[model samples]
Target: MGANDIFGVPGDYNLQFLDHITHRQDLKWTGNANELNASYMADGYAREKGFAAFVTTFGVGELSAINGLAGSIAEHVPVLEIVGAPTNNVQNNGSLVHHTFGDHKFDRFEKAHRQLGIKSARLDGEHAIDQINDVAQYIYETKKPAYIILPTNLVEMEVNKSLKDSIPNLFFNKEMNSENSFEQIKSSINNIENPVIVMGHEVDRFNVFNDIKSFSSNNNIPVLDLGLGKGNIDESFSNFVGTYNGQISDESVNKYVANADTVVLIGAKLTDSVTGGFTQQFNEQNTIVLNYENANIYGKSVDKDYNFKTIMTYLSKTKLDLSLPSIKNADNVSEIKPSNNKLTQSFYDKAISQFTSADNTIVAEQGTSFFGLASQKLPKGAKFFGQPLWGSIGYAFPAALGNQIANKNRRIVLSTGEGSLQLTIQELGLAFREKLNPVMFVIDNSGYTVERVIHGMNEPYNDVPNLNYKLMPKAFGAKEDEYDFIEASTENELFDAIFKAKEEKDKLVLIQVNMEMKDVPEQLAKTAKAFADQNK
Candidate 1:
């Protein structure tokens, strides 16, 4: 038994197996001291791997943490998980038990697993022990997570040959359909003079980040990253354009996209976030979406694409002569300038100038801050993480903590909204518990700015109780030596706090910037109007 070998429940098997697994060093363990920590250990493991973490429980205390885990996973980190189990003995005895509301003890785990793409299974009965080893092997091999049932009786069950032989068997089979989607893609590429390649998560999922860089270098194709795909490529690439989002009003990339006869989207999902809810102009007929699960050629959605690697390999070998070097070497590229709001830019610039390092990762929350921060230019190697798809508030604080845990050496800056900050503010205690260093910058305007922009003064009563944003770190139990608090009502104060936070590595800081609910991004405003009108 190895690291991966320790499965079912933390106490179900001995820790000896943890020493045998070659890759067990990477697992995050939530100790058996309590159920929450045990669950977090599993979550931390999934998060470190860049996969989603999930948990659902019918148990009382465990239920609160699991509810928090879903949004945390949905926004900051996407991990797969399932966890709901009541002792089968209680149910079998036909006694009035706590989790007897459902058919199975772990049904909540199954329900939540289905919501995401995660695969889930159960552990029950004496014969169910026969399957625990197989499930553990599946979790190890697939990099997907699982929630297992550990009855009180089975928690002490010894390892058996039935379990040992149940190690999962995995197979890889590929059958190419030569019917040819390539010809259509080729025709689209040839017809366009300025072709752009929009890269997304699929590239990273396929572990083709290097392949993408190489292909882009050889092909001289300009690259654009969709939402949540910011870190997919090196930001310093010559052909790289700014991120595409509704909050981004710049039309340079959109103009290039609209004019281009061929636009190759690699590993991108053309969902609402990436396409501004598909309101942004795009020539679907001339576009090619190359993804792991599917492909789009000349705007036709194909259920599947020849594997991403296979397509890239084929393109490299094809001797098709095409010269669009001008698109590659276009002497004039647009620069992402800070917005006209001098104060917002001043605060953002203060943070960026103070903490511009390759090791810094910015976590942006959706809402007003999303637009304000998106306009600021980040230094090379500084990655940005946000919850643009779900557009949920309060995700940045926890997500940043998660990212900080995953990359402890790097400094994390969280630019978030006051409204959303309240959602996961409780998680700040978790950050303090782990001693995770993430400086939070709250854009405090006293209300939901993003919601107001969409619906104007009627604002829909979107407001929360006032919070002492600057004192949050201390409130979450950070000692004087471990926490720094800064409030910025003016430009100089903001920059000073940012500089101090950036300079200090050992402490978690909270920089609260007083802001006004004015000057929303034009594009985001337009999107909001459309959204409101549609519902009306």
Candidate 2:
């Protein structure tokens, strides 16, 4: 309900609906080059602005954007996907449409989307208002994506103006009977000697950063964030440890988490990527897990109404053993003395770590970009965006566009591999059209570096045709003075390019950093080995 912008590509079926969006003075319509990028932009906007929507035509358009919608679902982002369908009579009579399968069947797309979305609804003129309100409420409460099919004939259908006043409140009502669950959690905490708090993506999804900080700081407990939960907490906190990625974590972080007597996991999902190929060794019987809707203590389930925030509030007052061990910060980048002077992952990591600040936002792509930035430190108040669970490449490009739109005052730095950027590179034109300035670095590794490490080392399938990345800005309609394009093949060139980009604040800067195909992040190499073994 609080969404400020809509992203989509205009189509014949969706034109009428888009016209209304353009007429609204309070809302902005971001027209992307393609539907996939549009959905990704909406996903990024939702992650930053709390709520976002994207519109697309039925069938082809909806299917094209399905991958982005799937990413939002996997990551628990609240996005409303509006699909513009044919007229009511056309659907009622099963008439063939351009985007249809030519069998007069139009419901197949909605059926497929239901599996990926929290809920799917097709609006009917007679009950459109009721259906819209129900779906909106569900999306707000669950913080998940939802699909809505808007028939072309219903675009101009008028309804009671008072329906807008009936939108339900989005907050969850505190349960009075949660005291029993609180007592169980307190007993579990009291039984443990060294308990550590682990933060996850849900902590940011529910907007409870302050609550977690208060609880961890007041209790003097050490806090550790998972890979996906990067930038969700203030890393500068005295008790805040670095990210814990099971086997891939730093020696100090792994020791603190692995040896703890009791682990308090808050809003965390131990996915394979985040857990170093499912290498975590914690005992569920000694863990207290708190999520959005429920809590579990030492393998015992709490009441369904016992939310994470309420449990954190209770734990703030309850005293547990404060004998937890302090953890030192992990040095993500190792000092490298190159023998041949070829660009390496260490140089890229250090350069990005130096460029990032509290006023910036970093968007990393799925493969090397995601794994490489896992250990990089961010300044306080900085935001990080990535698709770890979905593992979607080319997501960060358009997502960076959306993030910039949502937070226009902050600078955006996007790190993506060349292989990943090719999928959604058309969004660069949209960035030019919108006059948004984001410093984008394309890691020209020659191919899919992460895939090469996983199963295709020296394989032809992992290779991609290299393109002249510096010419892309001009091709995207950027004036010579409106953008800066550079190629960095050495450490000094990379450093100078980034420094120059920072000085040119008013224009978008595109930097192509060249690296060897085998130059992969250390953590990604280990994770890839595990994946290769598992697949074997």
Residue-level lDDT for 156 in candidate 1: 44
For candidate 2, report its TM-score: 0.95
For every model in order, what is the number of clashing pairs? 10, 0
| Candidate 2 lDDT tens digits, 1-536 | 67888999888888999999999999989888989999899998888888899999988899999999999988888999999999889998998769999997888898898765458989998889878878887877778889899998999988778755655453444455567778777777777777788889988877776777776766677788888878777777767777787788878778778877888999888898888898876868878898876678877798665756667666666655555444455545454332436678877876787778787889999888888887776667787868888888889999988989998899899999999999999988888889999999999988999999998789999888888887888899988888999888888788778889899998999999899889988888888888788898
Would you give me the overall lDDT of model 1?
0.58
Report the C-alpha displacement of residue 301, candidate 2, in angstroms: 1.1
**Number of the predicted model whose TM-score against the real structure is largest:** 2
State the lDDT of candidate 1 residue by residue for 44-100, as single tens digits: 333434453333344443444454344333433333333444556664665555644
Residue 334's lDDT within candidate 1 is 37
Cα RMSD of predicted structure 2: 2.2
Whole-model Cα lDDT per candidate? 0.58, 0.83
State residue 472's C-alpha deviation in candidate 1, in Å: 3.1
- Which segments of candidate 2 are over 4 A away from where they belong? 168-177, 316-318, 321-340
TM-score of each: 0.79, 0.95
